[model samples]
Target: MTDLSARDIERANFAFSVYDFDGSGTVDAIYLGDLLRALNLNPTLAIVEKMGGTKKKNEKKLKIEDFLPIYSQVKKEKEVGSYEDFLECLKLYDKAEDGKMLSAELSHTLLSLGERLTDEECESILKECLDPEDEDGFVPYAPFLKRLIAGPPEEKPAEAK
Candidate 1:
């Protein structure tokens, strides 16, 4: 929390609040892993335990104050892979050397691979970043991969005349 910006702290608070279902000002311990994932942190069960999360229902709870440090620690330790790494991996399936692959294959890989995404999550990404599938169901993958890694292109600010 010490190194986080005001906006980042605000976002963490908002995410934590979502799981505080009972308005008890604390979240159930069992939800810690889900909460961390919701905040884009890839925390393992050990990490969750170290951060004071317990699997026993209603046994422990996390206040936002306690959650902030955990969020900051995980965020600092998270190592997002480089864009080249992703591109290389995707190229393995690009048999045609056309920088395109079947849209269905891409979705399946995302749904089944490491850190698997839920169907809804996969669909959300595809809807946003994927081009319309061709008649044969292929879609250009390079651009889609770029968008996935770097997010949508930012709009340029209007220049003052």
Candidate 2:
């Protein structure tokens, strides 16, 4: 808490408030994981449980004060996926080691494997991250992975007319 910048604290507080749906100054323990993710901390289920997220709703609750420490701790401890990590995973699909793969295969994997993204979700990612496929239908994956890892571009505020 002491080391977090004012803006970081403010962002955490705002995220906490959004999840504190009842205005009760507390959030259900089950939502702890969601709150952590909302703050852009990718805590695993074990980490969430260690931080007091209960499997059952209302079994426990977290006040903003309590959440701040947990958020700080997880933020410090969690290592987000790096570009190399993602590339290595994608490499399994790129048998030729050509740094490119079939765009359709990538979309199929996204929709069918691991976390199993919904059609809309997969489409949204493809729309944003994919480049124009070549004649043979292959696409370079490094740029796509880079954009995906970087997340959506930040929206600029509209100029006052």
Candidate 3:
């Protein structure tokens, strides 16, 4: 596999801790589903069934090396959450007073907001926002935008004084 970033490594370690709920140094299928649900992700239906799937019933525990698939699913759901939040923020960029976030306006707003994207990058984002189904200059930020930027950062509580 490719090298994992520091942040990704941190996330993986934390996920391992969360999965190893019993302090048993390993995670079984039961713990795996629990971990997924705790993070607001639905567990794999096969695991939810617990006694199904092609794999032998005795081979239920998964090693850290086997965590890549679960971690990938977690990342996907986390990104979906970010995209949902970003769409809500896009409401602030409605310049035409018609509630539509136009491609030109979105491109300008993103740049003005210190997105630091190149012209080509911005155009690429605009293209993703506007597909064949959309009319020229008509882009639905709510329906799309997630295709451009991943979801928002995970929120943390403020430290008490």
Candidate 4:
């Protein structure tokens, strides 16, 4: 197994804490879906279907594990979230002025993780996060934090034959 320094583990735990709504320790698909929903992305069966392959009539629900490939890909594409990085992200996404985030806010926050986002992209992201269904089109901070810290699954050890 890869050896992670204590700081790395702490950072990971902090990240997890930021999103783990129920305090389950790990962030799973349901939580992710909630996060997406809060962000106004509302990832549905359609989106999950697109993630894996052709959409099927009776497709198996994609769990957090299902996102492993995407997570790995995202980790590769983007740098890991650090303590300061997470704090900065909190500041950016705190649209409600409550020191937290709405799921919709995360789209831009995530985009900003690697590169600067254009005005058009930022506007599009806002559109996605603020649900039209809501009278104000804004999400509260408490719920947002719950979904953000949902951590990745348990680390696996190297194969031993």
Strongest candidate by TM-score? 2
Give the worst 10-residue stretch by lDDT in candidate 1: 74-83
Q: How far out, in Å, is residue 13 in model 3?
A: 13
Which of the predicted structures, 2 or 3, would earn the higher lDDT when compared with the native? 2
Q: How many residue pairs collide in each prediction?
A: 0, 0, 3, 12
Q: Higher lDDT: candidate 3 or 4?
A: 3
Residue-level lDDT of model 1, residues 12-126, one tens digit each, is 8999989999999999989998998887766766778888889798998889888888888877764555678778888888889999899988999899976788999999999
**Model 3 ranges off by over 4 Å:** 1-81, 95-99, 132-136, 149-161
Q: Write down the lDDT that model 4 would get.
A: 0.46
Worst 10 residues of 4 by lDDT: 71-80
Clashing pairs in 1: none
What lDDT would each prediction earn against the true structure?
0.85, 0.87, 0.58, 0.46
Candidate 2 global TM-score:
0.77
TM-score of each: 0.64, 0.77, 0.36, 0.26
Task: Candidate 4: list runs displaced more than 4 Å.
Answer: 1-79, 82-84, 93-96, 100-104, 115-134, 141-146, 152-161
CA lDDT, candidate 3, residue 75: 46
Query: Worst 10-residue stretch by lDDT in candidate 3?
Result: 49-58
* lDDT for each residue of candidate 2 in 12-113, tens digit (9 for 90 to 100): 899999998999999999999999888877777778899899999889989888988898888887455678987988898887899899999999989986
Models sorted by TM-score, best on top? 2, 1, 3, 4
lDDT (tens digit, per residue) of candidate 4 on 1-161: 22444564454445445656556554544344343333323234444344453333223333333434433333333333444555655776666576545555565565664555776865664454433324544455433334344532358998999
Please state the error at residue 11 of candidate 4 in Å.
21
